[model samples]
Target: MVSGLLWPIIKKTGPLLMLLGLAAGGYWLNRHYREILTPDIALGERLYQQGVDGGGHALQGVTQNDIAFDDAQFNCAQCHRRSGFGSSEGGNYVLPVTGTILFKPRTFERADLFNKLFKESQGQVFRARMRSAYQRPAYSDESLARAIREGVDPSGRQLSPLMPRYRLNDTDMAALIAYLHQLSIRNDPGVDEQTVYLATVVGPNVDSADKTAMLATMREFVEWLNLETQGNLDHPNFSPGYRSDFAKAFRLWRHEVWELPADPRQWPTELASRYRRQPVFAFIGGMVNGDWTPIHDFCEASRIPCLFPFTDLPPTGHTNRYSMYFNQGLILEAKAMGRFLRAQKDPETRTVVNIHSGEPRSSQPAKTLTQSLHGDKRYLVVDLTFESIEQLRDQWQKLARQQSAPIQAVIWPGTFDKTIAAELPLLARYAERLLLPSPALEANQTRFPADIAGKLYFSYPYELPTAYHPHAFRVRAWMNTRDLAIENQRLQFNTYYALNLLQFGLEHVVDHFSRDYLLEYIENEAENQLNPGTFPRLSLGPGQRFASKGAYIVQLVNNDQRQIHPVGDWIIP
Candidate 1:
């Protein structure tokens, strides 16, 4: 009786156990297949971006007309872009290769069709001219491989001749396909269905007025953007016969302020904590008195864009992809000074003195100039550090007494006050030329001593005041209408420009809402006309982090009038 009872129970459980065994075996087989097919994604990234294979060799491709090209000349990023979202240029539309766009079946809904037609015709095209929606099946791995090597789509249609045929081996092709499958598949943080969030960074020890101006301008712009978006949504003007597709792109803007700690060491912790609580899509119109390295590093590590911070001391070295600056800051000014001194036709033997207060803002440029002219036999570089105006005066007197050759002095007092301004004219008598950064003179233009106007020169990184910038009037009118005070023009104008640039970049991405896509748009489509007359021209391109590339060495002319005039053309060093 016991054996019979056990036998019945075993019969009931035998089928369940067999089914579980099959399921486990199936899962193992699937995983094994995935492991076999999936190659290293980094190799694929290099192939897509740098056009290099896993073996450190340049990948090769062929055009439809049998023209061969190497990776250096024809990389995927050159056309499809770093985001893999593709772009339209020179009358050709490059199809997006991101996994989100590629792996799914291709079919346009009625709204999407209308939007495309409306965009292409600028809202003038009629429905009678509409064509049937094109359709294609979802791409399988084998189909995608064929498409890459043979220029054929999953629907057996030949791709455009502009699409090059790559000669990727089995392993390399799998890696490239895997990379494409992973490209921009998920939405970045700080974006939702109806709103996108952004932040502005404020570093420690910044002037209260400047900080206020930057924040006010950005906040006002965000408020205006939300109001406009609401208006568009309320009056979408969508009809059965004619649809307003542009209304779909409207999203409310949410702005946040991130104030960094006074201690630089705690910046990363603070930034990470704030980001964890509430992430932002990008940073716009930041202001700091000192170096921007800490903030820049945070942005880079987080893969967030930091746009156009106001500072005279940006980090030096290789160009950073995530951080875009207005210019190279004091480094540019120092290089310009070096170029000016080298171009001078004065006596071969000369003494160049670089004096500062040992602060990064002051000492960094001095160091840059000294390093730039290190091996030159034409002149001798003397670096001097002073803590007070009295100490600087004593050093100046001692230098004047011992100087044998003509003296060219570049002084950065670190803090430009009335006391320093008063002492600059007296110190200028001892040097053939006394150089200063434009920011120093601009900060104290009202109390600037006219006696030093003749001997003093400035490294100017902006358009001369005499040139007409009609856009400045627009900026002023916008500020006046908003009831915002113009305490700091440079700060306010740059802040306004950064906001406008973010707005422009967002407009291009529409519903995509990818940080990489936004950055790519900024790199390629930043308009010069958007500049608010703070700089001569503001623009950017791929791999370019600095918008302004040159500076002018200027002199304060017409001492009675107190006008700043350029000594020569702009110098790009």
Candidate 2:
């Protein structure tokens, strides 16, 4: 037929459209199948294997007595083993004083480590270790290089006296680091002085047999306060008693210390609510309302410098968005818990119950008495201890008898002791008891929203943990929601929305460093575990060059020792 020219145009255009459609289909498929690794994810895997905390590697499964250590012999049983504890098969005994350690954890950025080793300290925190290591002539630069290359300590000291140096051939170090170029970093958890112990600090490092006031402060913080020295970030102006007086904590460097009046922030107890909107001062405030007086009273009065000084993330959008410093937000968790439970809830009956009974929440995001629970949906909050078994059974019978849509959900969020959690009957009726856990949850006792001792009651520079909770703080202000959610039996602070208290401490930092190195080592661990004939090369999985799935704390549980094993903390089995 006398065909129209349309066939040519249609033929050309049809192919182009087909190509476009294929491209769209490919993009959708990639999005669906993409597997990204994240920092939080690595945290979920088990590495400690019953040997240590999430932040460290330790002999957890074995009792302290089981790991033989005689102090007079200065034995470190964990690594050196018990053949007289590093006495050695080679017939050479490693001397503790003859060697010192240079811990280059992966978290130790070379620049940062160089500064820490060479600069950064005007104080004496590291005097003993640094001085002792430096004094050894064998520890000269070449020796360090050889030790790293040959697995020896600087004093020609065999590693039993120290961490056995890795035999990183130059080619291996270069290629391995090249492989690690894509490794991701996120925030780290808190740590403290309790990590090293006072003896480790005072041992061979400090030549000063005489103690100074600074040493006294260090001693007290370690022994009593359970404080971890976080270097200089926390200067003199700090929390509690010293928050008001700068001179008490810090020697004023720039100017004369701003001597603040003691009574300046004392709140009038009756008019507490009036001062609620106003800061009596940053550090100072009395028990005006339910919230204890602001801990930053002294620093507030003097306007001492603080961390993260602004309210919102930068307008440039956290451009200074990157922070190596750990804030409570980075550490503490315990939001978004309701959603997880809400999703996994029983649908037929519409009852919501809360079961917390211990320390109540000091701040709440649950809004108000009316808002804590949905109005139309049925609500029933009960405590295991609230009623005798007979009464509770009767109540459960009633709940079970409710109309089809009578109760929506029962939110049982807090941690009851095993005795209670095991005994609670109604929880068995639910799909699953939601536990949004972090390493902190296991360690955080009744005293903390996170770790046991790491509360705002500690830490000088950081403000109250309650104040920093963005979701809770912003929402709670309107409703005077203080103490409401904490009272509600169904909710709790956990990894979902709760922050860990010790994230910023020194032990946390070292633990983080240890973990970071462990991660690099873990690819090796995994390879060894699988013993894959082919070496596993690093690749950004699926579609991208980076993933956030690499962060989780792995616990090794043998004989019920659930210790979090960071990668570098020890030799993995």
Tens digits of per-residue lDDT, candidate 1, 127-203, equal 33245356779888899999988999999998778888999899998888889999988778888878888888888
C-alpha RMSD by candidate, in order: 5.3, 24.1
Q: How far does residue 68 in candidate 2 sit from its true spot (Å)?
A: 74
lDDT of each: 0.81, 0.27
Native-structure RMSD, model 1: 5.3
**What is the alpha-carbon lDDT of model 1 when measured against the actual structure?**
0.81
Model 1's TM-score against the true structure: 0.87
Best by lDDT: 1
TM-score of 2: 0.24
Q: Count the backbone clashes (under 3 Å) in each candidate.
A: 0, 70
Off by over 4 Å in 2: 1-334, 341-351, 357-359, 362-397, 400-419, 430-573
Candidate 2 residue lDDT tens string, 388-411 = 335545555565465344432222
